[model samples]
Target: MKSSFLKKHFTFVFFIVFLLFSFKASAQKVRPIKSDQGEVVTMHSDILKEDRRILIYAPKDSANSEKKYPVIYVLDADNHFAQMVEYSKYLSRQDVFVIPPLIVVGITNTDRNRDLTPSHSNVDYFGKSDTTANSPYKNSGGNEHFFQFIQKELMPYVSSNYKTQPYRIFAGHSFGALTTINCLINYPDMFDAYIAVSPSFWWDQKFLLKLADKKLKAGSTLSKTLFFSDGNEDSSSPGSPFHTDVLKFDSLLKKRNIKGLDFEYMTYPAESHMTVPIKSYYDGLRFIYHQWQLPPVSDEKLNPEIVMKHYKGLSQKFGYLILPDEAYFNDLAQWLVKKPATLNNGIKLLEMNTVNYPSSSRAFTALGAAYVVKGEKQNAIASYKKASELNPTSNEIKSRLKELQK
Candidate 1:
C-alpha cells in the first residue's frame, strides 16, 4: 500500500512540472504592444548637475518625413504631460483641424519649489516665513540655473534628437507660470510664444508685475504671442488682490501698446486654480494659431494654388518652411476627385504631395487613385508600382496594382 501511494504522488508532481513548462512556453509566444506615442528620455544636465527625465510626444505620420514640428516646453510635467499630449494629438487631427501637430517636451521637475520659483524667499504664500528645518522653500530661487539648464542643456538635446522647427513655445502654471514670465521679461527671445495659466503674481509681493511694467516699454517691438489667465481665487470678491494683480498686468500691456506683441488675457470665474489649466490650455492654443485655419474652399473654387499660397503665408509667419499636412491635402484631393470640375485640381494636389513627401507610400497610393479616377491607366500603374515598392507589406496596394495591370 505505501509503495502504491508514493507512485501516485510522484506521478502528480510530474504532471504539475509539465503544466508549468507549457505555461512558460505559452507566455513566451505572447507579444508586447508597441507604443508609438513617444518615449521617456533621460539626460544628465551639466547646468543643474542632475539627471532629468523628459517626456516627448511626436505625431505618428510617415508622410512628415521631411517636415519639422513646432516644440512646446511645459513645466511640472509629472502633473500635466499626459494632458498636453492628448491636447496636441486631438486638436491636430485632420478632421478637428484646430492646430498643427506639435512636439510636446515635458520637463519633469526634480524640486518643484526650488526650480519653479523666481525669487529665493523663505516667505510663504501667506507672507510668513517658516525657519524650520522641514521648510519646503529651502532650495528656492533656482530659476536662473533652471533656465540655463533648459537653454543650454535641454533645448540643445531636443533640437539635436528631434525633427524640430525654429518656432518654440514655453508653457507653465502657477509658480511655473511665474518662471515663464521671468523668462519673457529677461530672455524675451527664448521662445516664440508663451502660455501662463494662473500665474502666482502675488509671489514676493507682486515682483514680476513691477518687473514687467519696467521692462515692457511702450511701443517696443516684442513680436511675440502671449496667452495668460487667472482663476476664481477671489471668491467673486471685487477686492480680490489675486485677480487684481492679473488685471494690472493686463492694463499695463494695453497701455504700453507694445508693437508686434500679440497678447490675450482671460479670467475663468468657474474654475479654481487647479482646474483652470485644461480650459486655459485649450483657449491658449486656439489664440496662438488663430491664423492657421485654411479659408473656406467650396467645390466651385477648389483651387490647389489657393492652398499653396495660404501655407506659404503660414511658413513665413512661423519662420519655417511649412507645408500643408499630407493627410489634410490627401483628404482634400479625394473630395475634389469626385467632382468633374475639381478633378484636375485634385490630381495636381496629389502630385504636389508626392513630391513633398517623396518617401510616403500613402501619398503615392493616393496619387495613383486620383490617376485611376482620371482614366490615366499608364500613370495609375506607374504610381501603384512605386507605392508597392515603397511599402512592400501593403497587400492592398499590390492587389490594386494587379487589377490595374490585368
Candidate 2:
C-alpha cells in the first residue's frame, strides 16, 4: 500500500510543477511576430532607481544595413506597445501613408501613479482630502523623476543606439496622458507633439487645467502640435460634464487666445478608457503629420542619389506595383523639372510612372517632354506618338507633336 501511494503522489507533484513552469514561461514570453522592425529590450536604469523594460519599434528599413527613422516615446509601454507599433507600420504603408514612417519607444512603468502624477496631493475626487493610514497619495507624484529617467537615461540610450531625428512625440492615456499634458504645460519644448488621450482632469481637482489657464496667456506663442481626446465612458447622462471635461479644456485653450498652438480635440462616443488608445493613437498620428498631403516643392525634392539608393528596397516593399495617379505623379514631375541639369533624373521619374501606369498616355507624354528638354528629339517623337495613339481625342497631343516636329 505504501509503494502504491508513493507512485500516485509523485505523479501529482510532477503535474503541479509542469503547470507552474508553463505559467511562468507564458508570462515572460513576448508576443511573436512574423515580421518586426522592433523588439522588447530590457534596460537596467540606475537613474529611475530600478531596472526598466522598453519596447523599441522602428521602420522595417530602419533595421536594414543603412537607414534611419524618427522616434515616438510612448508612456504605458507594457499595455500598448505592440498595438502602437503595428498601427505606425500599417498607417505609414506606401498606400495608406498619412504620416512619415516612425520609430516607437514604449517606456514601461514601475510605479504608474507615482511617475505619472505631477504633484503629490492628498485631494480626492469628492473635493476632499485623504488623511488615511495608507493613503495611495503617499507616492502620488514623481513626474520629475520619471522625466529624469526619460531625459537622462532613455533619450541618451536611444540617440546613441539609433539614428533619430530632432523631432519626437510624447504619447499616453489616462494617468499616462496626464503626464504628457503636464510636460506640455510646464515644459513645452520637451517634445514636438503631445498626444494626451483622456487625461484625468479630476486629478487634484483640475490642477493641470488651472495651470493651462495661467500659463497659456493671451497671445502666448506655444509653437507645438497637441492632440487630446476623451471617450463615452463619461456619458452617464445627457448634458453631463463627465464627458465634457475635454471640451471644457478645449474651450479654455480657445479662450486663452494662445498663438502658435496647433491643436485638435476629439471625443469618442463609443470608446472607454481602456479602448480609446486603439483608435486615438492612429488618429492622433495622422493629425500631427497632416502635412504629408501637401504638394512636393523644390526644397522638398527627393535627392536622386538617395532615391536611387533606396529605390530598389522601396519598390520591393510596395511589391513593385506602383500606380501613377494624376495628382501624385504630376507633383513629382513638377518637382523634377524645377532642378536644372537633372534631365536624367526627370527621365527616370517619368519611366517609373510609365512602368506603374502602362495605360497612361500622359505618362508617355511627360517622358517625351523631358527628352525634348534634353535635345533627344528621336525619343521625344517616339513618346509623343505613343501619347497620341493612347489619347487620340486630345488636341493638346496633336499640337505638341506639330510643335516638336517643327
Per-residue lDDT tens digits of candidate 2, residues 254-338?
8876787889999898887788888898889988876544334353354444444454443333223222334344456656766
Candidates' lDDT values, in order? 0.89, 0.77
Question: Residue 344's C-alpha lDDT in candidate 2?
Answer: 65
Runs off by more than 4 Å, candidate 2 = 1-33, 62-64, 124-130, 236-241, 294-406
Off by over 4 Å in 1: 1-37, 63-66, 236-239, 385-399
Compute each candidate's TM-score over C-alphas: 0.86, 0.66
Model 1 score (lDDT): 0.89
Q: Which ten residues in a row have the lowest lDDT in candidate 1?
A: 58-67
Candidate 1 positional error at 374, Å:
2.3
Q: What is candidate 2's TM-score against the reference?
A: 0.66
lDDT of 1 by residue, 318-345 (tens): 7888887889989988998999898998
